[model samples]
Target: MDKLKGKGKEAVGKLTGDRRKESEGKADQVKGRAKDAVDEAGDRAKGVKDSLRSDDDR
Candidate 1:
């Protein structure tokens, strides 16, 4: 998953002394953040769908 990969990159940055690795970690962190946002949006949409379905039942 994106989250796991992000953590791995961060760990590698700490383990190695490469500046590129550090930068890569930072980039991966950003990617992970975006992925989280997308997931939240998906959850919100699902909640709306469920609410609409319940209303239809009523």
Candidate 2:
């Protein structure tokens, strides 16, 4: 979602030389950064879950 928004903003900025478009791109980039952090945390959670499941199997 954030990535899509960021790409759209970036493309629009490139197409148009509007200051608002550039600002939008900056905002989207920040959103993307937050999304990346969330994804990393989710991945860590999944890894812990998998490790626990494997231990149970053993």
Candidate 3:
């Protein structure tokens, strides 16, 4: 996962005193979180759509 990789990179950056790597790692984590949010929203939408279809059939 991006978050996991980011954590590793952040840790290594801190140990090696590389600010760029640390920033990149932080950015990666944010991106991963955003992606997760979008996926969750899509799933929720699908659930709503399915429920509506079932209700219509009934």
| Model 2 poorest ten-residue lDDT run | 49-58
- List candidate 2 stretches off by more than 4 Å: 1-17
What's the distance in Å from true for residue 25, model 3?
Answer: 0.4
Clashes of each: 0, 0, 0
For model 2, residues 1-58, the per-residue Cα lDDT tens digits are 7767877887888788766886787788898899899999999998888888865586
Error of 2 at 47 (Å): 0.3
What are the TM-scores, per candidate, against the unseen true structure?
Answer: 0.68, 0.59, 0.89
lDDT of 3 by residue, 1-58 (tens): 8899889889988999999999889988998899999999999998888788865575
lDDT of the candidates, in the order given: 0.80, 0.82, 0.90
Best lDDT among the predictions, by candidate number: 3
For model 3, give the RMSD to the true fold.
1.8
* lDDT for model 3: 0.90
